[model samples]
Target: MLFLKLLGAALTLAGTARLGRLLGGRYASRTREIGRWRTALSILATELGFGALVLTQALERMALAVGGHPGGVARRAVALLHEGESSAAAAWRQAVTEASPRCSLTPEDEATLLDLGVYLGATDQEDQLRHLKLAEERMVGSERVARGEQAQRERLLGTLGWITGVLIVLMLL
Candidate 1:
């Protein structure tokens, strides 16, 4: 499981870097010829979006491994809670702190932490809730920035597509 997670991280990084370089090159050429600031901005946005997507996917996979099956970390934590081995808050905090460092948490890990924190808090685990909230805040900021960039790219692409269509129509005439 650990190996798989590591492999996923490596692949995500490689893919993101390759895509960024390809888009950046295209943006540079377009900007040089047309001086369209939107093109460069769009490229930057696309890169950010791509990076977020890759990280999100990886984190989602990790979250599933933790929360999904009977043998998962979440299940084990719950079991500990039931067995009176630890309070839910303590169990959650331990699980997150231990897992975060070992798993080399990506941005998506924040989302998982936020969800788990809320759950722990609901179950009367205030300390875990506090830490999870902090993690959530951090992740939310990054996500918002990434989303803003993605929205800009989408708008720019739409404008470019319309202009291209108009040019094609003129040529056809």
Candidate 2:
């Protein structure tokens, strides 16, 4: 019976630890993704400053960062953008909205991204840069909040795991 109690405690602690790590990993991944998007937007804006490309082409290239690859939803949005101006905007908004739930971003981040889609290629080089900057700022804020929450959650889970384990073992006794 003592052995069984010990085993149960250990398993409980292990599971909590695993869950905490998973949560932390998720936050880290989100930060990386958001950072990547910011970098890509900065790059695009810089390119635009030198010489403007077609809006569709700019979006397609930006998709590489947003989608994480050529086959990403953002890239597909770029294809839709090529069809018509309104369709392209709708596609961008849809992509952002759909993607929000899949990651650790706030609704504000999604809204900022959607707004960015409205101005990405529709504006002049300076305005595009401004919009991209706004988006980057929003992403940075979101990443900070996410990282803080992740750290707190990890700590809480870790503490809870040990506490639960101890309680379980005591109860078994």
Candidate 3:
């Protein structure tokens, strides 16, 4: 009975630690890049293949569709972007939430994304690149913060699990 209890504790601690660390890393990695409707779309599409489509990806798909359409794709993309700020904002918010599980994004990150949507295909190449840079900057900052917290969070969970199991064992005794 004692052996079973010890084994259970050990497995629980190990699993908890591994899961925390893995999720943190995944979260950090998922936030490595941000904007430019097409680049964002391309990355999101790739993410889709992995079943991780986020709000940003949805924007990307919309941009790609509009840009890739055979007849006056550029003109159509422009019209959609011009549809209204609220329309773009809603989509941007959705992307951020969709990716919430895998990436912890700040309001600033969301704002930057919203800005990216506004310019989207509506802007010239240089402008698009600028928005992309802004998104990338935000993501990079977020990733750094996430990476710093990841180890600490993992350790905390692991230590707590260990301590909890030990306490349980003592109580049973």
Candidate 4:
């Protein structure tokens, strides 16, 4: 019985600790995901501004060049465009909406992307490039905030997990 009690307590501690770590990792993931988006946007800007690619072609190239959620968004937008989504802005909005749920982007991040979509392919090349630059700037701000939260929250959650496990074990004892 005593051995069984020890085993249960050990399991509890391990499980809670793992759970805490998983939760904490989300903050870091959000930051990384934001960075990925920023990089992808920069790639898109270059493709549009210098490579002389049309919006759809630029998005396809961006998708090919990048990976992860940002890439997925670009790929989906391209697919939507090919499927007769009516406009580049519509496709971008739809793709961002679909990908937002699966990604670590905050609502604000999602909104920023959606806002960027509105000007996509709707204006001259210079305007399109300007919109892309603006979005990248917003993403930089978001990444900074996410990095700060990750730094502060990740370790705290991990420690709290262990502390909570200890409390639970004590109560059981």
TM agreement with the true structure for every prediction: 0.30, 0.78, 0.51, 0.97
Better by TM-score, candidate 2 or 1: 2
Which residue pairs come into collision in candidate 1?
Answer: none
Better of 2 and 4 by TM-score: 4
Runs of candidate 3 exceeding 4 Å displacement: 1-108
C-alpha lDDT of all candidate models, in order? 0.43, 0.68, 0.51, 0.92
Model 2 / residue 144 / CA error / Å: 3.0
On residues 13-116, what C-alpha lDDT tens digit does candidate 2 reach at each position? 77766765675577667667667666766766766666576666666666654556212546667756666665656887766766666665556766777888
Report lDDT (Cα) of residue 141, candidate 3. Answer: 68
Check candidate 2 and list the clashing pairs: none
Q: Which window of 10 residues has the lowest lDDT sum in candidate 2?
A: 64-73
Per-residue lDDT over 90-166 for candidate 1, one digit per residue giving the tens place of the 0 to 100 score: 76556555545433234464345535544443433344335444554554554454455455654565555555545
lDDT of model 4 at position 102: 92
| Per-residue lDDT of candidate 4, residues 1-173 (tens digit) | 99999999999999999988999999999999999899999999999899988888898888888789988998888888898836888888989998877989999999999999999888999998899999999999999999999999999999999998999999999
Report the C-alpha lDDT of model 3 over 1-173, residue by residue, as the tens digit.
98997787777667655665565465444344332223544443344334444434444454555432211222333344456554544444444445444434556655656566575544555565566566656666666666566556656655665666566556655
| Total colliding residue pairs, candidate 2 | 0
In model 3, pairs of residues that clash are: 41-60, 55-95
Off by over 4 Å in 2: 65-73, 83-86
Best-fitting candidate, scored by lDDT: 4
Q: If the candidates were sorted by their TM-score against the true structure, best first, what order would they fall in?
A: 4, 2, 3, 1
Report residue 137 deviation for candidate 3 (angstroms). 1.0
Steric clash pairs (candidate 4): none
